[model samples]
Target: MHTHHQLIAEKSVIDTIVLSLPFILIITIYLTAVFISNKKYQRWPFYRIIFFIVGILCTAAALIGPIAESAHTNFQAHMVMHLLLGMLGPLLISLSAPMTLVLRNLSIKHARMLSKLLKSAYVQFICHPITAAILNIGGLWVLYTTDLFSMMHSSILVYTVVHLHIILAGYVFTISMIYIDPTPHRTSFYLRACILVIAMAGHNILSKWIYANPPAGVGKADAELGGMMMYYAGDAIDLVIVVILCYQFFKGNSYWTKKAHSLS
Candidate 1:
């Protein structure tokens, strides 16, 4: 019993240190980039810097501190962590336009190379709305339905990989749906809107499934609460995405229409 407690303690310490490293690194790099970029070119948007910081805090809140510790055994806490890590964090970070900031900071040659990479076939494929949806929503379905949830709790490596996937998949999914950054391969607003609806439906369905059939180790009560949170909260964030996409679509159309009228 003593040995087990000691092992748990050791793991907790390790998790704290390991998890903190990334957030610290991200903040440092981001601030440095912003500073250098502002000095060289037009000052970077102050609000975007705040967005990036808040996004980092949201992700950090999910990964570190008491909430993260509770998440291992508490399904409700885990769901909250999921919302922060995968949805809200990604949304705010996407709004920050970090890639655009980076492009502005980089030398012309490097920026061109980065832009070229963005235009590459692999980038285009992964950034497609359909593919992003599969990676994001499909992955959640697999995790909650299979033994993966239990395995993630048991194994540190699995936990790390799952969290990384959640963050990256969510970010990719958001960017795929909305054009906050310089998209080299653009899709029509109609297609993106359709894909967003399908993806959100998949998410809603998965939450309902979790409520009906709890994950391996999670209890029914916890599952119900988490499912509800996932449903309503997820919808709220998704609604924001919908509103932004619609606004941008109509705004762009308006500009084009006026341009056409002037030409005529």
Candidate 2:
């Protein structure tokens, strides 16, 4: 078993690259962008230090920690890692309101670029709530139902692609459902909320499905336990999103209410 596990760990060069690249790049790119924006606007935030620390911790847990090492040998561990990377981490980072920070920090020109990016067709298609739901939840369905999950540790390309999906899907999903950033491509509050409900329900149901119908290579008991973990843990992170959205909605309503009273 030790030899077998060790052999499993001895992944291809591509796998090594894939495993490290996103972890490296996302932090690098995001920090760089944040720094540039901050410098431009003279916005120095101490909270940013905390964001980097926790963000890296979450990413490392999913990628380089003992949890990641065990993912090849244990299906439950892999599921947990997926939740950390693709669900919790993205959701938390989104709550950090990084995009807003950037917008507040950037010059008008850069803010306009950011807005334009949000409105672009590529962004519109990928960042739409429905599309994010498909990518985030549907990707899980594919990974388990197909051989993708089992094969991830073997090939770097597969692992890389899968990791990329996790991050992007998480990112797109967060941005689509929540209003942390200034979006030029705005969906109606009702529409976004309705989609959020459907997507959240779908995610919870997928966990149950995984429990009942264990994916290949994973035992039914393990899958069930893992699925349970996903159901509760995902919601804990999601509640913050719910709170933020409601706050934004209520704040907007209050502004309108005050305006109406003033006009009266």
Candidate 3:
């Protein structure tokens, strides 16, 4: 019994270390890119570095430690993890402009290749606001409304895949809405705004659905609390994205008008 307990403790430690490595690696790579880019070009923005680190920390906080463990059984905790992994982390990290930093750091030939990739039809399609919204918000609807949520807890592969999808989908959805990096395939502001509204409605509707119909294993009380958090907290983070998108639109319109007037 003592040996079995010791084995369990060792496995727990291993699990934590494994979980920590990705965030550590992300930070290290980002800082390295910042350092190289600052030397090659003008200094990379200090605030961007801070934003990247804090974003990564937010994701780490959700995936590791007590919150991650509790999420398996407690719906409220799971909701918190979802908010961190999907919405807040992605927004902050996108604001860091990691792709811009990478472009500055890469060789001219490699940079062009990356640019070409970005301009590809496949990239443009998947990065479309509508497509990203479906993947992010619609994916959540499928997960909560189906047996997928319960399966995620039972299977490690399912859990990892679901978490990865949440993060990637969120990041893509955010970058689609707000252009923080160089997007060769840019959509009109009005179009993106329309898509954003639709996506927001989908997300809100999903939260209310979760409130009324709990997932397979989650209890009623937990579902209620989780649903409320999902509704309100999701809005708060999304509001930041809306504000940024509006500012970008305003600046873009001002630029075109000024150029037009100068030509006249």
User: Could you tell me the TM-score of candidate 2?
Assistant: 0.81
TM-score of every model versus the real structure: 0.93, 0.81, 0.95
Question: Which portions of model 1 miss their true places by more than 4 Å?
Answer: 1-18
| Model 2 agreement with the true structure over 1-264: per-residue lDDT tens digits | 558667766664447667777667767766777777675676646576466547666866798757887888777798789888997777767656677776776778998988888789998888888888889888877887678877887898999899979977987888888876677677777877877788778778888888888877788788888888888887777776677677888899999999999999
lDDT of 1: 0.94
**Best candidate per TM-score, number?**
3
List residue ranges in candidate 2 displaced over 4 A. 1-45, 101-114
TM-score winner, 1 or 3:
3
Task: For residues 71-158, write the lDDT of model 1, one tens digit per residue.
Answer: 9999999999999999999999999999998898889999999999999999999999989999999999999999999999999999
Clashing residue pairs in all predictions, respectively, total: 0, 2, 0
Better of 1 and 2 by TM-score: 1
- Superposed by TM-score, candidate 1 places the C-alpha of residue 80 at a distance from the truth, in angstroms, of 0.4
lDDT-wise, the better of 1 and 2 is: 1
